[model samples]
Target: MSATELAGTAPAEANRIGAIETRGIEPVPADERTGGPRQLFWVWFAANISILGLPLGATLVALRGMNIWQALLVAALGSFGSFALVGLISVAGKWGGAPSMTLSRAVFGPRGNHGPTVVSWLSRVGWETVNTTTAAYALLALISIIFGVGANSVLTVISLLVFVALTLVVSGLGHATLVWIQQWATYLFGALNILVGAFLITKVNWDAVAHAPAAPVSVVVAGIGVIAAGTGIGWANAGADMARYQHRHVPGRRIVAAASVGAGVPLFLLIGLGGLLSAGDGSLASASDPVSAIQVMLPSWMAVPYLLAAFGGLLLSNNLSVYSAGLTMITLGVRARRVVAVGLDIVLTLAGGIYFMLIAGDFYGPFITFISLLAVPITAWVAVFLADMLFRRHYDPRGLMDTGATSVYWYRGGFRWSAVLPWVAGIVVGLLFTTASTSATDVWFSGPLADSWMGSNGLGWVVAFVVAGGLYLLFGATTARRLGGTSSPDPTTRPGARTDGEPAAVRP
Candidate 1:
């Protein structure tokens, strides 16, 4: 039986609402790839419309010491530029019809792909945890406003459960459902967000915002890197996860444009709003619970509606993360249904949300630390993957799924040294310039070059990208062209068999 048969749905019925998507890491058959670039626009737009961007903008002004104009510029460049890379990489999904990490097996080999896959999975889970905690806080604050009940340990636990359950309901239904929800939800919450934003504008101290001091050009450059790492770099790994459902013939530029514009517009506005809000009151950047912190600026009636919108926006983001994490888990060789994988990921997210909300006590410190540390490996993986895409126009779908010695990607005991070595070298070099700190006074880890401009500005991820991508292009381009040619027959016709016709022993 074909992979789609195993998924228990006809091509027509595959992505319908209320259907639980049982497909694992299998490359989506061409018939099932029906969506256009517009779908991608909605997917990315809904995913980023959350209130989280506000805190990011506030961080720019309060922590990075950028004025409002500088913050807006940084927001535009960082969010659009980073997601443009995301859009570029998403083109691979249209070619392979597989999840991002699954397509990565073509470059990294099956066994060697595990390291980056693990990091990608962890990043997804971490983001889900953060979203869950934030949503739960919004719920608690809403309850406190409605019922006159303050947050307690019990309320915290209950709130977390509520948010997690809501996420599971949408994510567990899978792709068609998520796509549908993302579109309609974007319309509803996007309008509500605009309404709330209009109210927020009245609260901004325009005089304070206008008079804010401009920082040095060096600070602005550093600010751009920080915002990029926090916003789009964190999302770089999951670019192809959603695009897997897009039609193979969809123009790559359209894909890129969809993702970049869909995400960038809202992020630019929200982050700028955050900078504006922070100019009047800098507390949002430092608050232990940001949902509660922002409430002080709004009236009681607007507060309830705003918090509800926040909760819904967070749900939108969390469900997407959970869905993608489920796919990543399957790509990591988990032997279970996709919904089962989603449940497992959510359990970890729940634990993390509990600990962070009840135990950690400090939010921004740990969040900044998390973004700084993980950005290196994810960026390194992204670099190698994008560089591989330069010469490798087609993915041998059978080779992507085949783990046996017969697979073309079974290079050198299932490790593509050319790609793997560059990836590792990138991470190592990136870390040499990385310094992670939980607080101003507390340093978690500092590399040899931590005091240098790149280190201080958090450009280690950029260095990693350049090192890994440049090295791959220099050393691996010739081999990739010879191996990853488009001469093979289409994948749909011969599902699991090798398309290259060469004997397995002669692959390398």
Candidate 2:
């Protein structure tokens, strides 16, 4: 369908203002926004209710030796904590009415902001690539089950292309269409998950649940860290992308709840299910590759529909990732339409996913690498980011939108050392405690915390937040952030920006 047709089909209430979502990086004008916090809940809730979450939880069960309850507890703790950050950053959505990365320009400065933007872009693409790959894996497995043609190298390639095609079409249609699609997709996912969850419940072995491997205290702590990093810190960079188009008067608390509960519930549930399935004596329990075990669960009749929903659901998941990726690209001074930028993401996804699928073995290593590597730096960045919001109590959305001489963010050739220096420090500190392995391990700088108290793999979240936030306070992120530009009142606190504005990406 044409983009016009897609937009036309959306509910009138959603598009009543007739805001053309063409301006990718600009602050949204007040008149253009048209939603309350309720929309945010559905957007994130639907996105999280996918098969993508299973591997994270399943790994915790089989690899970390966590019992079902322990895995669920860790998963819930992480889900609650990380998603809170997602909610905190989501406040920028209503404040700036622009992409979250663009709003970040205020903190990082224009040129310096590009660093995080690129990092955000790469990280989203990495996760999206993994999402697509998992969908491809499941879809191919279904094809194998039905046709009796084994899922092979050729089918894997085919499934990926099919997945990529779906994401491009949905995201290419842009925001309003994407939102509309997610609402219905979420309903479908919820229905399907209920069926799957019930099926899994009947198959659980309570004996194994009782006798599952006992985890060390360090392992339990690390597991909580891993789950927290994966679920909580996971949403840090993308919060504003989801909520930016919310009506300005929507209470901050509501937006926070919308983003937090939206993603957190599904993550905790799905991961818990994976852990439960792994711990049981069901068909999945003895499977050599637990991540691939979801394939065998469906009855013959439900098989195709489940696969269809799973693949369709992947597009729902990838849409926002690609959408934010495009916005991040635009924020980094890439000049392109959001649709075109998403097209670029498709190209990269194609290359990256294919390359990884070919040479990758034991997804255990890659998944940990992907999540842990990105988790810490982002935690540090968000730490400083949240602290900036708290201390400054204001951000001029104009500075993010303007990107010109008078803008307060235009400092030191568009680089703010206050933010970036501390962020870099946080990254190094995070990595100091980070260990490189297929599974979570400790490295040189694992610190006395790990030496005496717990294992080091998941400690970056706390360390980064504290170090980066403290450094920013010392660097005067609040009092004096720029050398070349004079400070002003928070742009968002003021009723308006000096210039007429246009709509930008909403947080999801």
Candidate 3:
């Protein structure tokens, strides 16, 4: 087939459908892959980081205090490129039959995979915490607006618990459940935001929006990095994992692109606008509380609809939070049925969710910090995985399966010590930078390097990528020459090979 023909027709989407038509084993069923580009778009749309705005916006507001335009610019910069990274990751699902976590085996090694997977698990758990906390806050705000009780009242606790329980119940169903929830939530929230935002625009002063202060470059850069990291990490790790199931009739790359934009951009705008609106007025304190902001934005007549819509969005957020948690658990080699794995995820997620809801005071800082910290290793793994595929031709041609678990990755118990050193160095540098920026005057370095490491994790990601790649090449070269001498075959140019079902082990 011509490359374009090969790229377009019988593309990644077709490979997935063929597997399903032939009754192949996969985590999510083929019927679940039924969405067209539009559906994929909405899925992406709903996936955009919604509550993230409250925390992220709050940080900027506290630091440099950006106004609406400035906030939007930061969001745009951070949010746009994220989807592309995710789209690249989604290629694995389409080409290889693995889920996001499963794909880690290639770069992380079978035994080494546990590090990335654990990092992924923690990241998802942190997300669950943020969702639960946001839901709790939103519910309390709504209850006060509707019935006049205080936000921290006993009644609010009961309401939050009930919602958490419900989230847990629904989260147990896996992909089928997630897709359905994604559709309904996106429609409900999208409509509500439009309706309320329109009313608010008419009622409120547009001058205030224009008068808002511009965000500082440093703050804007940090904000963008935070948003980009939040939006892209999982998607980058698993976009293909979800996209792989697209029906043969669906266009592959288009679905990926649509899904990315749908999920990342809308959420960015939604949260960014919320911050803008809240900041202009004294409601800045409740910037994270979408329902309250919604009610304030609209007239009494529109309150019910806005609340209903916001509630749906909240549910949708929890659904994804819990669903992705299920994905991480399933990546474990324990081999439970898909349904069972999801059930486990729901239970575990609920416990963690509730704990965070009750205890986490400043949910935003920890939410961003935990995920950003965990992302370091996963990003390293991804950088290495892509490099291996591009230059080393690691996969067997006939099956397209990455059978390098033994020859390529099996070095040092499948954990490259070389890669480990770089990872440690990156973390240490990133952490030191973070500490120096936050406490340089007290802890010494307060000048150039402090700013250099001001938003240390952001720089850490790039450092980790370069360091890991360099270490992999250095080690891979020596190992390659010693094991087989001369040269190693390229993966992309060769015919595919079948798998022996020996997925890279993820020993933690």
Candidate 4:
């Protein structure tokens, strides 16, 4: 259907807007965007590989005692879970030509949006810190190998500084530069992983791999599925940012087509390879750097390539986190130009690196365990949003003021009781569940019957998502507004809405 038809507008009106935006028919014109299937395909492919592929591989080595094969399967499934939100964002982008946060106003209301928006911003910050530190450590390891300064503190410091400098420089280039970085990193990491995989496969004792104390194949498969589900989770949240570029030009199917080819296929290959290799090596429980396994597996002559490839692969992964972090800051109204945001990011990155250097002792498991645990609440938020978008027709945000209860807080008068009560309930329930799950891991499950039922971070997310989404639905449809929602237009989208008077994709 045509844009006007989809939006429930008349043909004449749609034609007029199309002419204005695509041609020179109207005053205050916008530039016509170029590219269709190919650009989108490359962007999606580059994004997936750089953002999730290698990191998921590395993470699998560290978590779940996954051999390469098992790790890849789990990580791939995790990616599926993550992409659930991406599917919805793609539709919103095609229909509204708005960024994800802007579209969020419809559900949260203008002022009420601070909840999710702030969470996104802060979450990205933490991710950035983690990425920067990890990349620096990887690079430092490579430098140590080359210079014969194995485990030198000074080298580590120097690598940390370099990461800070590079991230800040790239931040000034804004989205376009970041996109370029992702593409370049994707190619680089792909080459590296291939080399690593080849070396490791050659070195493997097939008999040892076959005999490793095998978890039930089904358990391993299910674990692989779990990891895979979480792999592309961030892509869903960030899809609108990328899709905004496409929606202006390409058709919807083309966009979805690009996502499937670009993200889905390559990711499966990379993570699956990593998992298989990890499964073959029974040392997954203690392995932090999956690439290191290949190092031993490879001949001495191959060591240089393996080390360089490892550094490049980790660096590429870090670039995604930095880019995403910067974008999240922009959405949060960081008030600085792209360069300024980069500068702040550099400072944060260095601080994080230093913190890691000081705090990292003999154990890595505790840190990842903590991060995974803390990530539950955020994942819960994603799950709830995904549920509403997929199952309910009433939650559509294509047109009208999408800001439901959030609108009441930001633009309209009066508190949205529906949101407040549900939010509180979700938070309390989420906290209780997280605590219970942590205790359960320590073998402490004694609690009230209901509390016992709520154990596990995964379960906590389920509770929070259901409660929050249910509340939003109730408030949006029933009560004061009735099922139709308040017809009164939201002020956020009004001509009076705030703007920095700058384009969305501005460079520094």
Candidate 5:
């Protein structure tokens, strides 16, 4: 089928303006895959150009004790390097034309994929909730600056509702709409951010930034780990979700470049600026309300635009997350339309936002703890998924959608222990070196090796990735090749065969 025929065959509402996407967990037809790599650039760039990076940078200086120069280097390395992995994994989406978790059916069997899918869903929901809370704070700050009304429970609820509603509108519209919004929004909000950023630079105390002592190499390494976990590692699982729309012919290198450069450039600038701001005033790192904290540094005249840009940025990020979370929900066996899944995810986000905004005692404390704990499993999954990607280039689309016993991915009763064992072992090893805390004095979970160099340096996620990928390559490589090889039974005759007449791949 040609592009025109494929588009005509699709439901009119699919990817149409103001229409909820109807597709769920199935491979998008190759003829319908119209997007290219450049679109991915905007998608990732816009998703990441949020004000959240500022606080991440603040943490590096205020909590981790790094100077501006060291912070910049860490920001560059962590943001670019981790996202490069994200881009690499995205290539699987192009090959399979399915969401990330759906593609994983080939590596871990249908049932076995659940563990990583659940973790990915939780991570997306957590991040969306945090984005909602932060965006709400920005809206509240805007109201206070414009109308002189102080924040109260009523305003808090209203603000959260507004952000969540906006997220639903964009994310619920699904792929085409998100791709369009991310591109234009990146232009509009990206420019506004630069304007606000320039104004912010003038406020920096260069003397303080320049004179601050450089952090020791160990802390620098730790800062890199912190930045990587906070920025790219958190985004790794969702990488291929957006890439499912891209044409399979697009070079894998282009996909990787798009994600790395697009996200890396802005992150480095934003994080470095954050370090500069913190160098002058330590308040940003410890600020109870980050929106208000950053607002204090700007002149009253610049407050409105700054807050608007901040809100817009967070909305962009949240939309992508909510969209991915919805896909993840379907991958987790939620029987509903994609839009319906998005609505369910938003309900959880609203509840989490209310707790963090109105009931929680501290923000950064809990925020850091959330990142620390979730990063381990997410990284472990990424490692195993990327490892699987090495040997399995073409995904058997029918096998991916078919969860029954006849499915090629039904290795040993719906589970592939080769992948499952490495993933579980990775998480276990990671947690041993992991330490999570809600505050300096309020420790959440501290492993036996928490005080060791890897633990102390916040490299548990790194250790997890290495262990999982290495172990998979060592023990699971042959299994992966055998399972993904052309010897598998033909899927075209299967019950779940592609009705669209797309050719089947030999391996998944």
Candidate 6:
């Protein structure tokens, strides 16, 4: 078969597209693998150190009545657990040099993996739309304030196209350029945000923070859930996408530490900043836009740089989302080239951004809904992936990436009931328990469980990981070693199977 014929939306080998990102889902050849734990950290930081997490923190204060300190604690709690998983998934990247979701084929059958890939794709698109809309709005606001241009349909459309074009171009250029941009952009944002944080510190009213009516304990718990769900669970699916480029022998500890610290710090600090802002002077509470709201406290010179950072952060956020979306586009069984898959993703981002901005009466309502909705299945999938890595120790990126029907991942006509069933169950649990009240809409799709107890703190995603992990362990204990057990290879095992962690002493 031709190399092109063997790939799923494969990019041509040895053919450099905009910059050097020649590899697709195929295992990264040892000679081509580059970077280390620090790169993963910065990659995650660049993607995260944005104005996005501020709103999540603000929601805790504005809607849940959380104090700044309380919000900080909960935000830390959120970022702490989520980024740790990012670390774990980064380890998976060392073992399997493929796109993050492609590893789902190792858990689910190639065909069955489609279900999770679809979820990943939907989530990336949703996030891309959100990032694009916010960035475009920032640009429109900049032009209006700096250039005296008024906001209008034409300007909005132009700004959206501009952001879409920039992000798409960067993503289309592929990984090398994306990583370089993230490394530098994160440094810029980190420095600027520190200055803004210091300025905000001077203006903070300690009385407001200390005297703000303490939220109910239940409300506090729910607030933790909101912050954690929005910030942590949302990033679960994309963990390995960044780390897969590392050398396999690089210590997993470094990978996990770097990524966890990189992601966790911004989320903790910035969300705390938002809660602090919302608690005092009511600037966060009163401002129309999340990114620029805090700028009201800064001098013109400071605000300009802060605003630019906001724009950069948005582009970085959308750039990563689009890259992931491209990976997912290929997983949908398309045989077209990688660039074609990315183009399809760009089209979706544009269409979705325009629709939400123009037609969706309340974008934040659906945005929050989108995040909460995906948390469960994503958490569940992560649990299974981690469990497989820890106990059932084998991976086959070559098999998963194969386009031929003969691939070992084509189990039971490409469906793994063990993985799919639990994922659906977790989704049901999420639907039953997820609830959060937003200004635009109260009770954005909650079920009896949430109303009966826990308010909007829906801990279903936690339960999902526990439940799905336990079930997969059960399935693996009985089914085969290849499914995450410690036993001799079975029909599922191929000659080239990468058995990184299997030890007979721990065999099931």
The best candidate by TM-score is: 1
Could you give the candidate ranking by TM-score, starting with the highest? Answer: 1, 5, 6, 2, 3, 4
How many clashes show up per model? 0, 13, 23, 45, 0, 2
Q: Candidate 5, residue 109: CA error in Å? A: 0.5
Report the C-alpha lDDT of model 2 over 156-253, residue by residue, as the tens digit.
78988988998887777677777877888888778877776777666666788789977876787788788777766766788888687788889999
Query: What residue pairs clash in candidate 5, if any at all?
Result: none
* lDDT winner between candidates 3 and 4: 3
Model 1, runs deviating above 4 Å: 1-12, 477-508
Instruction: Point out the worst 10-residue segment of candidate 6 by lDDT.
Output: 499-508
Scanning candidate 5 in windows of ten residues, the lowest lDDT window is 1-10
lDDT of 4: 0.49
> Candidate 4 residues 1-508, lDDT tens each?
3222322221222222112112110111113233255554555665555322543554455444545555545555555544544655665555444445544544444454456656665555555565555556567656666776776677778878877676665544444455566566667766766766676666545664455454446555545433533444444555654454443546666676666666666677666555545554545435443344445556767777666655554454455455555545544555544345556766776776677765665223433443444444455445444433443222123222222322222433322334444555665565555432223255222223234544422344445656766765665455425423432223223333332221112110
Each model's C-alpha lDDT? 0.86, 0.71, 0.55, 0.49, 0.85, 0.72
Tens digit per residue, CA lDDT, model 6, 1-508: 4333434332434423346455556666555567698888777888887888877777778767787777888898888767888788878877777777887776776777887888888888889988987787678777877988988878888888999899878788777778888888777777877766777777767788889877777777777767777875787788887777788779989988887788888888878877877775554643445655666677776776677778888888888888878877777776555666777888888888787666666556667777777787788888777877764344654566654455555555656676777676766765676665445346556667776554346676766777788877777666664545443222234334433322112111
Which 10-residue window of candidate 1 scores lowest in summed lDDT?
Answer: 486-495
Off by over 4 Å in 6: 1-20, 213-219, 280-288, 295-302, 403-405, 436-444, 480-508
Candidate 6 collision pairs: 112-414, 392-484
Off by over 4 Å in 4: 1-41, 47-76, 94-98, 208-230, 288-294, 384-427, 435-459, 479-508
Off by over 4 Å in 3: 1-39, 58-62, 65-67, 143-158, 165-170, 202-205, 212-219, 247-252, 278-303, 389-412, 416-425, 435-459, 469-508
**73: Cα error in model 1, Å:** 1.0
RMSD of 4: 9.1
Candidate 3 lDDT? 0.55
Winner on TM-score between 3 and 6 is 6
Candidate 6 has an lDDT of: 0.72
In model 2, the worst 10-residue window by lDDT is 499-508
